[model samples]
Every structure is written in structure tokens, then in C-alpha cells.
Target: MSRVILVFYGSYRQDRQGIKLARWIVEALAARGDRAELVDAKAVDLPMLDRRHSDYREGEAPAAMAALADRIAAADGFVFVAGEYNGGLQPGLKNLVDHYLPQFAWRPAAVASYSAGPFAGIRAATAWRTTLGAMGMVVTSTPLSLARIGGAFDTAGLPAGEDGGRLIKAFPRFADDLCWWIDAAKAQRAAERPPF
Candidate 1:
């Protein structure tokens, strides 16, 4: 069976470049036959963190929050496409995720970080690792970082020019790592009950 993976992008910038990276991640994962969906923070338009989805009583959560919680709970894995802001997580993505806890538990999570500068959002990726781990996800060991986001790819997420070759080469290993964990987790979930 195909795994449903949610690729999240949390940039609300007037001129967001990280979106290219996000598109690339979703498209690339799709090409590998994973059912990948892009969950844009801006498009999702969730209000700032207040009442979490878990806080609401049954049938009481807002329509948007309830819908998103269902999607998150059904997904087998996740990819957080982050753009660095002052060497940390982007508010849009962080706020989107902060609304849930149990929904993210026991899943494999990956980080695909990018930036306009040379660092490729590595700092944000580092910080996000801690947060994802704390949220109970089995964060992937491999990370994809793209520097100079503006020139990395077109809207379709295809790699561009000199960077094309590097990205093409890097994606397979990253996907492989995530897939391995996904398979392992699925097998374990089927074989035994999770310890609460």
C-alpha cells in the first residue's frame, strides 16, 4: 500500500522563495510513488496558537482545525519544509504544528530546509529536529538543504541549472531513509500495539 505523506510549508512572506523548495519536495516524493500532499501554512490560514485541536471537546473543534487533525492523524509520515528566520523555525509552520500533540506521535518526520543565504536554513533544521523529536516523531537522519532558494528551481519543483545535478543526486538517499523508517513503523504498528 502507498504511504500518505504530508509535506508542510509554513511561509507567509510577501515574496516567499521557500515555496519552491516545498514544491520540489512534494513533487519529488510523488515521483517516487508516495502520496505526497503540500500543506501550506498561508493557504491553510490557521489562526495563531490559542485553543489546540486536542483542547476542543468532541465535535467542538473548529471546522478547519478538525479537518487538519483528521489529515494529520491519517498521514503515515511528514516532511516539514522550513525557511530559516533568524536561525530558527518559521512562525507560520511552528504555529501550525504547535496546535497538535498526539496526532504527530509515532510517525516518521523529515526536514527539508532552505534559505536565500549560504547556510541553507541548517540552523532552523537543527532547531526543528529537537521540536519534532519532542513531539514524539522519529525524525529522519537525512535532511535536504537548498541554498540560494531563488535560483534552485521553477514552480514545478524541478531542479535548475548547476544546482540541478546536486539536488537530483541527493534526493534518492533522503527518500530512501524516510521510506525505510516508514516501512519499519508500519510493520511495528501492525505487529503490536504502541505503548502509551
Candidate 2:
């Protein structure tokens, strides 16, 4: 089965809109019989980049960075559920994204953003999509959102109306597209001869 990593990129440890969205995405992905791993950025002790001035390579990086990269490389695809901070992607999410470069190559990615205000992290998602695109990731075209999250979501984590149905409907297509891209990338990589 294809594996997809769902990353919840919020600083909050307790239940929040981003985490809630991540859970739903993971559940939706799992329901399709795919392997979905939900990774919380809070749990990953990410520190600022500590690269040496002379050493351009990140050889033997800190355990947290190494683990973060492993999760990215292990999955055939990724889903990001992130919170908006100052009308942009949260610091935690940016830190996680900066940890790896080429390792993210050609993998598929989807993003869901949430915020209390009108934009609903749409600007943040746009920023994140650009960054991921530079890493050669096939970021999903359908960006999901829960605008005015404080009003839209109940304490139980359910969205308020049929509008959420549209969001939910978009998720499966995103997942299916990721699956397709992953399979295609794997096949293309395998075809390159390196057998010894």
C-alpha cells in the first residue's frame, strides 16, 4: 500500500484547528486503504539550522532533523495541515520544510490550512506551496481551507455545514492524485539503471 505522511504544523500541543484538520485528512486517507502517518511538528524537537560555515552538507544532522527527513523520505506523499501566523505559514512549518532539500524531490504533497479570520490560511498555503514546489514536490492543486475556523468548527471538531462537504470531497481526489504521482515517480526512478 502507498504511504502518505500527514504533517500537523502547529506549535500548539493541545487540540487545535490544524491538528483537527490533520486528523480528518489522515482518517480520510486511511479509509481509502492507504498507509497514513500523522506527524506532529510539536513532537519533533526542531531547532534552528546549525550548519557549519564550511560544511555545506548536512551529514550526520541532529537527530530531530534526521528524523524529520526520514519521515518525508519514507512516505510516497505528504499532506500538510498548517496554521497561519501573521498571514503566513507558521514558523514551525517553515522550520520543518527547511530541514530537507532534495529528499523531497518529486513526491506529491497536499495542503490544508485553517485560521480564525477570513483568509483561512490561504496566503499561508500559497507561501508553503511555493516553497515545496522549489523542492520539486508535486504540490496538489486543490488547497483546502476552513475559513473563520472559530465559527466554522465545533468543539467536537466537526465543520458547520455543507461547505465542509466540498472540502471533504476535494481530499480524496487529492489523495488519489498523490497516489498516482508517487507510483509514476517510483517507476521513473526505477527505470534509471544503477544496478551493480
- Alpha-carbon lDDT, every model: 0.89, 0.71
Model 2 has how many clashing residue pairs? Answer: 0
Best by TM-score: 1
For model 1, the superposed segments whose C-alpha errors exceed 4 Å read none
lDDT per residue, candidate 1, 65-163, as tens digits? 899999999988999998999989899999999989999989999998888888889999999999999999999999888888788886566788656
Candidate 2 lDDT over residue span 2-90, tens digit each: 55665546555454556767777777778888778777767776666565212345556666667667677777777778788888878
Global lDDT of model 1: 0.89
Backbone clashes in each candidate structure, one number apiece?
A: 0, 0
The window of 10 residues in a row where model 2 has the poorest summed lDDT is: 49-58
lDDT of model 1 at position 121: 91
